[model samples]
Target chain A: MIQQLNDSTSEAIQQLNDSTKMFNLYLKLGFEHLLDLAAYDHLLFVIALTVVYQLAEWKKLLILVTAFTIGHSITLALAVLDVIQFPATIIEWLIPITILLTAAYNLWTLSATDGDSATQKTDLNIKYFAALFFGLIHGMGFSNFLKSALMPGEEQQIVWQLLAFNLGIEMGQLVIVGMVVLINFLVLNFLKVNKQNWIKIVNTLVMVFCIWIIGGLLE
Target chain B: MIFFLQILSLWLAHDIHLTKAQVDVNTSEQSVQVSMHIFLDDLEKVIQEETGFTEKMHLGTEKEVPEGDSLLAVYLRSHFLITANEEPLSFSFVGKENSQDLLAVWCYFEFPLSDISTKKLTLTNNVLMELYNDQQNIITLVGPNKKRDYLLFQVDEATASFSY
Candidate 1:
């Protein structure tokens, strides 16, 4: 009992001392979310969204990407702030499905625009809107992670830590975009690869990735 | 550029995670052994909050609490309670072992009467509830050979009743 008394005394002191470790920890977690190859769901979603757009459409791409960012960020904040309870097992299953749906929609949009420049504008608009909703689901998926990392952190501090984490996720995402753009430039511009062939190859790979993830999750 | 990226990631996947408690009732021994596994870092954080301890409390580095107390034991005693057949069963701290892989540890506690012969047990586990709103505690009860039961405890729900 005497030993127990001392332990609690010290711990109470530590709580009064606020530290920056939590901030740095959350920031790193945000970056890990995007880059962890062990779980490529987030990476695949970003790739599928950006594969069709050229660097020339930078403004449009920025708008679409920002929409996704805002959508997920809101849910992540809600999860951390409100502590909204939900079943994580169900959320885990939905994440892979989200990737599958996003990839399928990409393939559908590609076929819709087949050799037609006129319909491209309409297709792009729908994609932008879809990105926002997809962001919400992705945000919930992200929330499962935030939930695990939320404890022992001050409720108020989490707000700032979450922002840091979101910023890290976005940074990791930008790196992925650079890689995608680089590959696109190399394959289409230098290798003289056909645009159709490139589209088919990348989309097919992502589709297979989706199936692989789904298969693993089911097991 | 990608090298810089790789350095940023893979630093450590030492993520904040859940806890697991295994309860085994040895009919012959007349006692139940509860082995609770929790992340060392997280446990320390929660401990720091409840107590005013500012020292770096790592595993195997046991020191008297500033007020001369056993931090782990005291914390566990308050949040983890067990009642058998609707009667409360007290837990006595036994020992703990830490795995070198980050801050995960297996903490041992005991209930003197676990000769669970057709009896019921209800456990209230709020181990990390105050620190983490989504703290998850998994409890598994194992018998001599073939019987196994499990209970999941979340923040909102902290009690699980078991009969076997």
Candidate 2:
């Protein structure tokens, strides 16, 4: 009876260890997905979304990113659940297109618009909505990565894995946003770069990169 | 502009480097089956580097190399290993198929076991670890009596064992 009790206790500990390891593994995978240079479309989108804002607007930035995360989370779950399916190539192509549009929007707002407070409010609302919608497309791209990594007969643990993976991605995005904000602060304050000029420069560069990606996809 | 061009050139030649494997042990059949998912381009590049195969393998394409399977088998035998009860077990390459996107291939392998009960099972999967520093190999092993184990293999750590 003593041996039996010991055995059960060891088994329980083993089970807990296995679960914790699994969670950490998925979380790392999700974080690495954003940081992976080969899969830079997601990284590009985050940068484009971020360059338009200043460090003072972190609260609004947080909400905008969360909206995007919520949007992608829904579609990511749907795609992983096998409820919706699309060609991987199409999703890959669409990712760069989203980045291109976002960059263009940034350029237009910076250069073309004389922003009164009311118009700026409406513009911010529009930006939030666009982030959410583009996030849906990005979610499909993420689903391809998760689906390829998923193991057969591991459906029971899918929920936990998905949650951990999404959390990791969110954390990774915030890190990128933080770095961009810090750079903006340093360049504007120390280097004395004009905020408007800086935003325009970054957006223009992003647009050029997006075009190159889209052009490659077309070929 | 120069920095952008350099990054563009780098991006053109690279894709995510990840491989996944599933190991299923059947107590009733006294057999173990392993399936691995690998990118075709990465496989070709690695094979070229390891085996001195200069020709384009065009793996997963209509004009695939005739000796692609044999080359792949040799590579797998050298890189991936399975051991049962502290004794190394040999596996035969069963078959392979193109993944849905055709960007990757799933290779199947089988290991016949003499004893149904295995006290310890160890796997060493270092496939593509040498080529890419960021390469990751995910293994999901299902042992006897429906016991499951999962491991992520990186360049530094490539071996894992399960004790039943």
Candidate 3:
């Protein structure tokens, strides 16, 4: 009886250790996936999202990003579980298209008059929805990476992995959003760049980069 | 300057540097089987740099160099190590196949053991570590009775142990 008890105890301990390691592994992968400079498509999207808002609007920005996090986590879970299917190539093509649309929207807002309160409200609402929808597309892109890491016959542990990976992505997203806000603050306050000019410059750059990426995809 | 160029080129070439290895312990067979999935581009670059072969390896294609297999085997022999009960177990390279997506290739190997039912196993996997600072190798071990364990190895810590 004592031997059986000891065996169960050790087995429980081993299971706990295994879970902790799995959590850390996926978390790190998800974090690094977003932060990877080599693939800056996601980074560019986050920056494009942030540049439209001033430093004071970080709270609102955070809410929008959280919505994105929630949005992606849903599809990431669904896609990996085989509840949904999309071609990997098409998903890759769509990722940059999202960035291009966000940048183009920024340009459109810039062209509009700055002080229309009703337009601002409508724009904010549209942006929230856009961020969430874009996240679903991005989540599919993430599933490709996560699927590559998965082992066959280990579907049971995916819940823990998905949770950890989504959290890691959120954490990485925050770092990027924070840095852009900081840079925007510094450029506006210290360098004395006009707010409209800042938005135009950054959005234009993002648009140009996306065009290049799209061109490469076409080639 | 050289280091900066290397880092820049690696960044420009690929988005992620990661590999997955599945190690299966077969008690009845008294052997361990390993299947590793690695990016084709990364493997080719590493082999070329290590072996001083400048030509493209063209792995998984009809034009694949005949020397590709031997070069890859040499790299694995040095970078991936497995031991049971502190006794080194040598593995034979069986073969490789390209993933359906063609983004990566799966390499197969086997380590024959006298008896693997109750032995402590340690693995040292440093594949592609010398090239990418953020290179990660994820190993999943399937033991007897379908018991499973997952391990993550990076440049700083690249060895993991298991017992069954």
Model 1, docking class: incorrect
DockQ leader: 2
Candidate 2 residue-wise lDDT, B1-164, digit = tens: 96565334334433567899888887787888989999887898898899998999977778888999989998988899888887888878998999875668999988887777677888898999889877889987777755667788877889988765
Question: Candidate 1: lDDT of A100?
Answer: 73
- Give the whole-model CA lDDT for all candidates, comma-separated: 0.72, 0.84, 0.84
**Residues B23-100, candidate 1, lDDT per residue (tens digit)?**
877777777779887877678888878877777765444553443227888888888988877777777988888644
Scoring each candidate complex against the real one, what DockQ results? 0.04, 0.27, 0.26
Candidate 2: pairs in clash: none
Worst 10 residues of 1 chain B by lDDT: B6-15
> What TM-score does chain A reach in every model?
0.85, 0.95, 0.95
lDDT, candidate 2, at A125: 92
Expressed as tens digits, the lDDT of each residue in A1-219 for candidate 2 is 999999899888877877887788788889988887756789889999987777788888988998889889998999998999966667777889999999888888885346688888888899899999999999988888888788766799899888888888998898899889999989999999998889888888888888888777656
Fnat scores for every prediction: 0.03, 0.31, 0.31
- Model 3 CA lDDT for position B40: 83
Pairwise DockQ winner, candidates 1 and 2 = 2
Rank order (by lDDT, best first): 3, 2, 1
- lDDT per residue as tens, model 1, A117-211: 76887887878887888887778777766655543314656677688778888888888887887788788899999876777778788889988
